[model samples]
Target: MFQLLIVDDEASVVDSLADTLPWHEIGISTVFKAYSGSEALELLKTNTIDIMMTDIRMPGLNGLELLALVRREWKRIKCILLSGHAEFSYAQQAIQHDAHEYLLKPISDGEVLDKVGNLVGILQRERDESRHYERVEKAFQEHLPKLQGDLLADLLQGVKISPERLGQKLESLKIAIPAEGRFALMLFRLEDRFAELDFYSLSLMEYAVVNMAEELFEDDFRLWSCKDLHGYLVFLVTIAGEGDTQQDRQEHPDRAAEPVESRLQSMASQLQLSVDRFLKGSVSVLISRWGSFPLDIKRLYEDILLSMRKQVGNQSGLLIYASDELEQLPVHALQRLYEPPMLVHLLESGDWEKTHDKLTGIWSELGAKWADSQEHLLEAFFSIYASFSSFAHKNGRQLTDMIGPHLSDVTGLTPSRSLEALQQWMFQSLELLQQCMENETRNDRENTVRRIKLFVQKHLVEDVSLQAIADYMYMHPVHVSRIFKLETGENLSDFVLRLKMEQAAFLLADPSLKNYEVALQLGYQNPNYFIKVFKKYYSLTPQEFRQKLEAVEEQ
Candidate 1:
C-alpha cells in the first residue's frame, strides 16, 4: 500500500482529478487532497506519503516552498509540480528542487497517470530491493555460527588455510580469535548413558555440551566447536594472549604456551564435571597441547585423535590429555574430499563438467601426496565409490547394472589393490553412470515433449496456451516452455501458433466454409484478427489466399 498527496489551489481541480483517476490501479492506496500548501504540509506531517503532486502556484506558501520543505523533512517522498505557467525559470526551479516531473495545467489524465504510474514502479522497485537486502542480511546473521563452524572444521581436517584467508574468514564470521596464535584441539565423546538417544536427542546433547563448553572456556580461550563427520564434538580452542606482545613471546615462548596448556587441562576436567552434574551425561575429553594456530591445529587433531583411540580403548568419563611430544602426522591432503567442488555436491547437482574436474583433482592429489599410503588410497577410493553407489541408488539403479558386479565388491578390496586398478575401475564406473544419467534425462525430456505435442495437436482449435499444455501435462508452465524449446528447437507459443495457422489454412481451402466460420472453427472469434494473422503469416488476406489456391488448382 502507498500514499499520494494531490495539492492544488482549486478544489474542483483536486476533486475531479481524485474522483476520476484510477488511483488504486496505479498502486496508490490512499489519496490525500489539500487546497493550499500549508494544508499539504500539515498532511505530509500526519501521513506516510510516498508521492506528492502539487500545483506550482498556491495561496500563502507556494509549491516550490512546499517542495523544499518536503525534500528536507521527508527525503524519500517523490514530488511532481503542476502549473499553467510553462516558464523556463519555473521548470529550472522545479528541477533544482528535485521534482520528479513538472506538468503544465490542463494536463490530460493519460499524461498524469503515466507519470504517477512510473513513480509507483520506482517505489515498488525500491521497496523490493530494500527487502531483498534485509533478507540477505538476516540470513547471513542466522548462518554466521554455522559458517564459522565449517571453517574451523576445514582447518582441523587438514585443509590448507593461508594467513590472509584465515584473517578474512575470522573477521567475516565475527570470531574474536586472532589468525596467528597458540591453539589446541579438543575431542569430546558422550559416553554410554546417552548412546541410545535418537538423532534429535543426540543433537540436543551436542548443543548443550557446546554451550556449556563455551561458558566454561570463553573467558580464557576463543572457542570454536562443531560435531565432525566422525561424530566427535571437536573444538579448535585458541589460547587468549597474556599481557605480552609477539616480541615478548619470542623471548619467552614456553611462558606463553605452557600456562595455556595447564589452564586448558584444568578447564577440560571441570567441563566433564559440569556435563555429568547438569547434563546427566558423562563425556570423555581429549585435550591437545598448545600449538601454533591453523598450521599446527590439523597435525594436533591427527595426533590427539590417534592417541585417544589408542589409550581410551572402550573407556568412558576419562580425560586423555596430550603430552609435550609432537608427532609428525602424515599429510593426506584428503581434506578436499569434504570441501567444495566435492564429488557428492557435484553428483547431487548433476554437474558432469565440475564432477569430472573434481574427480581428476582428487586422483591427482592422491598420486602426488598420498601415493605411498595404500591405506589412504583405499580410503579415497571407498569415499568416491560410496558416493557413486548412493547416486545410483537415488536414481533407482544399481552400480552393478552400470559397471558390472566388480564394483559391488568394493568392501572386499584390500589395501594391496593397485592404484592403477582402482583408478581404472573408478573412471570406467563414473563414465558409465554419467552416460546412463544423460540418457535417462534425454529420454524423459523427449517423452514430455511428445506428450505436449499430442496435447497441442488435439487442442489446436481450443485453448492452446502454454499454461493449458502445462496443465494437461501436470507440469509448471516454465518447465514446459523450457524443455519444449530445448527438445524441439522452437518456443512453445510458436509451436502452438504454427499449429493454429496450419489448421486455419486447411479450413480456408474448403469453399463451403465462410471466413467467419473458419475463424470461429479455429478458435478466433474475430474474423478481422484472424485475417490479420493470416496475412502476417502468408503475405495475403484470407480471401486473396483462397483465390490464389483456386487459380493454382485450376491451372
Candidate 2:
C-alpha cells in the first residue's frame, strides 16, 4: 500500500482528486488534500507520501521547483504535474525536472488512475528487489565465518585440494591471504584459569582471545584463526607487508631491526599479557616456523603440536617457539590423551561415556606404543589424576573423597605401578565419580525447582518472566525451563499462569475489594485482560464469580 498527496491552489481541485479518484483500488492507502505547494510540502515532511500530484501554476514553490526539491530530498517519491495550460514550455520544464507524469486540467479519472497505478507497480518491483538483496546479504554475512573456518580447518587437517580449488575457496571466502603465500602457525591453549568455566563461558573467552589477537596483529599481519580439533586456537598469520614497521621500532628508530621470529614472539607475549590483564585468563602460545601455504600447513601444525606437548606440558602462560632448537625426545608423546574432546572437557561436561572412551583410547595407545616405559605410565597417571582432581574441586569435593584410598597413596604412585593396576584404579574411580555426580545432579534439579517456585511466590506481584527468574537463579533461561519441566512434569509458563490465577481467586474472596484493585495487586495492570483470563479459568467473569460467592455465603 502507498500514500499520496494532491496539491493545487484551489481547494476544490485538491478535494476532487483526493475524494473522486479510486486511489484505494490502485493500492494507495491514504490520500491527503493540500491547497497549495507549501501545504503539500508540510504533509510530505510529516508523512510517507509515495506519490505527489501538484498543480504547476501554484504560487510560491511552483510544480517544477517542488519537483526539484522532492527529487533532492525524497528521490523515491513519484511526482505528477497537473496544469491547465497545454503550452509546450510548461511540459518541457516538467520533463526537465523529472516529473513522472504531465497531465492537463479536466483530465478523466481513468487516465489518472492508469498513470498512478503504473508508478505503484514500479515501486512494488523496486521494493521486492531491495528486500531480496537484503536477505541475500544477511545470509552471506551469517555463513561467511563458518565458510572461512571450515576451509582453514580442512587445510590444517591435511585435506588435499588442488591449487586451483584452494584458490577458488580462498576467493569465495574472501580470505585476503594468497594461497601461495608464506604463513606461520600459532597454537594457543587456554590454561587452568579458564578450565573452571562452563562450555558457553569458555567459548566467549576464546572469542575474546581471538578478537584481542586480531587487534594486536592486524597492523603487521593478516590473521586467520580457528579452534582446532584438539580444543586449541590455531592462528594462521602472514606478514601484511615488508613496509609495515613494528610499533616499537617506529617509536625507537635507533634500535636494530629484529627478525620476524622475534617480532612474533614479542607480539605473542603482548597477547598473553593483554588476556591476563583484561580477561583474567592465562594462555600458552606456541609459535611455529614460517612455512609455505597449502604445502607446509599440515606439517607446521604437526610440528607445533609436538612442540606444545613436549615443551609446554601441564604449564600455563608459557610462550614457546617451535623453530628454536630443543632437545629431541626418544619416546612418542601419547596422542589420544591430548586429542580433541580431551578428558578434562568431557569430565567438566559430565559426559561419562566419552570420558570412558577417552581413557580407553589413552590406555590402548600407552600399551601398544610405550608399554615398557614407566615415564609414559606416569604421564597417563598424572594427566588423568589432574582431570579428576579438577572436576572434583569444581564441584566442591576433594579427589580423596571421590576415589578413597586409591588417591590416598599418590606419593607411592600406587595407581601407576602396572598397566593392569592403573586400569583397575581408573575404572573404579570413574564409576565412583559417575555415581556421585548423578546423585548430585538429581538433588540439584530438585533444589532448582524448589527455588524457582519460591522465587515465583515471592515476586508474584512483580515481573515473573522466565528471564527474570533465570537472572535470579544465575542460569540460562532455557536451562531453567528445561530443568523445571523435567523435575515437575509441568511447563514453567503454565505453572506461573496457574499460580497467578489461583492467587487471583483467593484475592477475590474479599467482598470489600474492587476487581481492578485485586488485579493490580496480582500484577495485572489491565483489569479487563485480567477479567478475561479469570473467566477463561473459572468459567465466569471475576464480577460474576464474586457475586456467586456472595450468594453462596448468604445461603
**Pairs clashing within candidate 1:** none
Q: How accurate is candidate 1 locally (lDDT)?
A: 0.81
| Inter-residue clash pairs, candidate 2 | none
| Worst window of 10 by summed lDDT in candidate 2 | 323-332
Candidate 2 lDDT over residue span 216-257, tens digit each: 988667789898888999999898664446885676453345
| Model 2 CA lDDT for position 283 | 92
User: Which digits, one per residue and each the tens of the lDDT, describe model 1 over residues 385-410?
Assistant: 88988888888988788767865566
lDDT of 2 at 476: 63
TM-score of predicted model 2? 0.45
Q: Where does candidate 1 stray beyond 4 Å?
A: 1-132, 154-168, 177-180, 196-205, 242-258, 323-345, 365-390, 398-401, 404-417, 505-515, 526-555
